[model samples]
Target chain A: MNFLAIIGRVVLALLAEIGRLSLFIWQSVSHIFRPPFFWRLVAQQMMRIGYFSLPVVALTAFFTGGALALQIYYGGNEFNSESIVATIVALGITRELGPVLGGLMVAGRVSAAIAAELGTMRVTEQIDALTTLSTNPYKYLVVPRVVAAVLTLPLLVFVADIIGIMGGFVVGTTTLDFNAGVYIKNTVDFLKFDDVMSGLIKAGVFGFIIAIMGCFHGFHSKGGAQGVGRATTNAVVSASILILAANYVMTSLLFAN
Target chain B: MSDAKIELRNVHKRFGSKVVLDGINLTVPKGQSLVVIGGSGTGKSVMIKCVLGIIRPDRGEIFVDGKNVLKMDSGQREAVLRKFGMLFQGAALFDSLAVWENVAFGLIQGRRMKRKAAKDIAIEKLAKVGLGPEVGELYPAELSGGMQKRVGLARAIAADPEIIFFDEPTTGLDPITADVINELIVDRVKDLGATTLSITHDMSSVRKIADRVAMIYKGKIIWEGPRDRIDDSGNDYVDQFIHGRAEGPIGMDVLKP
Candidate 1:
């Protein structure tokens, strides 16, 4: 009975948090329409969440695409289906690898940064300062991040998709015996707008999850330095897990033939 | 109308098995500087957080300008928040943005002014905090501790709030810098004609900047009076804390192995 009660309490707590989160979202959306929009913060968040993140995302995509191309080339040759290398690389990167890898990379960098930044603010009481100034901390801190993440992740993924394909190209043409023209042509042919679009959509969802997890953990951080550390770790791990879980669900819905 | 800018009545806050704030009652008159002093873990920070709604009280009411903050809708709460500013313990500047941008964050994001105007105001605020426009071009990580604290102060005052919260604002600074900060706090607050509430264990800060001082012990305000009377507070807890004596009412618990 005690264990059941604990479980029930946990569920209730989760429901309460969901309710709070939804309310926060509603307030943020209303603020988006309200006068005195914070364009500077929006632009600042865009640069922080998107531009500074480019190097890590680019590095991950390049390596993953290269590795995937090599692996597929070797495996496909054994099955006498080596011509599928370009198609497989293109499809994989566009449909699964690009968005998932990009999201995960961003989750590692951006989530940790957000959590740390906000956690420090929490512990040091800058968040309290925001409130004392007659400003909403959620509106001031969470909204820009969430909005920027939602809007900019697609653009980041678009860049990631292109970089990843290039990575596969380098390996397929230079290391493998595939014709450069054919590889490029096959990759182009296999990729539809929907395939690319799906990845971008996933990116948007992943971005939202990352930002939420970061803000939630930071906003609720306890103790001091150690607590902030825990919040940052939780932000990264939870965001990565959520990104993967969300990718599976999204992919299934987008491609359930 | 009540002259009190903020009033807390019978406030209570608990975290699981521990009660962080117990029936906290305090008042700050308009344009007055009130400092809350206590030992570490005495809930000095928690009490201030409760007033700002960073942590909600389990029971009781908080009024800012005679408005019951606990009962306000998000819209109303945010409106109330706009009247406040804060300086955090560790100078919680956003590392990503240049110094000016951090100061102007509220003006641009919460107020939705143009970037040029915001940046201009940001620079001006930075100057008020004894920083030049060149310093505004740098990121928080590039700044020294004193600079960061000054920047934090700039950000806090950026919106020209009618109320300000200072959380351990001088704890981490060197004596000279701490004195400078204390003076700046007094100067800026006086300039705004703002009501101020600050939490700190630093006696020097309390003496230099506070019009009145309240000492919290074990989640309650044990003593409160004009700053001049703190030396003769006659309460053992307040005496022990302000004098930095480990004996008397405050026991020295083993902090770590």
Candidate 2:
């Protein structure tokens, strides 16, 4: 009975946490459509979340694409070498790796930053201060990050897709002794529009998850510096896990025939 | 009081099993300052937070300007919240924003005033708090604790709110600095003719700002009267707390150092 009670408590706590997160998401989303929108703040956050993160995402995509091309070339040497290498690289990057890897990178950088900023605000009573100042903290703080993330992630993923494809093209032509024109043609011919579209859709969802996790953790953080630190770590960890989980679920649904 | 600007009736709030506010009944008359004083963690901040809608009470009715805030919709609650301003303990200035932008946040965002006009008013309010116009260009991180507190005060009063809340306004400062802030608060509050609700353990601040005083112990208000009666409340907890004595009805279970 004692063991069951412990298990029951853990389950209940998990359920409670899910409920809290759902409530936070609902509140943040609802506030997004409300009037007196902060366009400038949204722009500022886009700069911070999407713009500043460009180089890291770009670098990651390039390296991953090149490595993927090399691996496919080595492993599938028995198959139609040139066609298979180019097609798989394009399909893989556009469909799965682009959004997933980009989301994880952003989830690491942006989620931790948002969580740390908001968590510090929370522990220091700044959130309460906003409420008393007649400003909705959701609109002023959460919405900008959420809106920017939702809008920018797709853009980031698109950029990643292009960069990743180029990385593969570069590696195949220079190292694998493939004709550059043929590689590009093969990539274009095999890759469907739906592949990229689905990834971009996933990017949007991943963005939502990242921002929500960070804001939720930050807003609810208690204690002081230690609590803010915990929030930052939780934001990154939860966002990364959620991004992967969400990517899997979205893939199954989006790709279902 | 018929003229009550803010009133709480039998407010109860708890975190898990720990009750932070237990049947708190309080009132602040229009244009008057009511200060709640207690030892640390005695629910003084929680009670005010409950009033501000930052923390909801488990079971209670909160009225602002005779309207039941607990039952109001978000739109309605926001309308009511416009009357309030708050100065938090740690200053809680937005480090991301310049000091001027921090002060102008409410005017530009909440009141929808033009930025140029708001900037002028922000500078004026900063001047009221003994901050120079040059100080407005610097960020919150550039300021000392006392200066940050002043900027927070400026932000709180920027919108000319009719009601104000000060959460530990005199905390984490030297005696002279705390006194300076307390005097500024009194001066600024008097200028606005705003109703004020403040929570602090600082006796000097309590004496300087409060028209009426209430003491909380173990989540309940144990004594309340005009400021003059605080030293002679006839309540043991109140007597012990105000005298800053360790030998008291409160903290009985904790061992003396």
| Best candidate, TM-score | 2
Q: In candidate 2, which residue pairs get closer than 3 Å at backbone N, Cα or C atoms, i.e. clash?
A: none
Q: Which parts of model 2 have CA positions greater than 4 angstroms off?
A: none
Model 1 segments more than 4 A misplaced: A1-36, A40-83, A133-135, A159-193, A222-225, B95-160, B174-192, B227-234, B242-244, B252-257
For model 2, the docking class works out as high
> What tens digits encode model 2's per-residue C-alpha lDDT throughout B15-87?
9999998898888899989999988888887888888888888998999988899999988998988888888
Residue A122, candidate 1: C-alpha displacement in angstroms:
3.5
**Candidate 1 - CAPRI tier?**
acceptable
Model 1 is docked with a DockQ of 0.44
Residue A42 lDDT in candidate 1: 80
Q: By lDDT, who's the top model here?
A: 2
lDDT of 1: 0.86
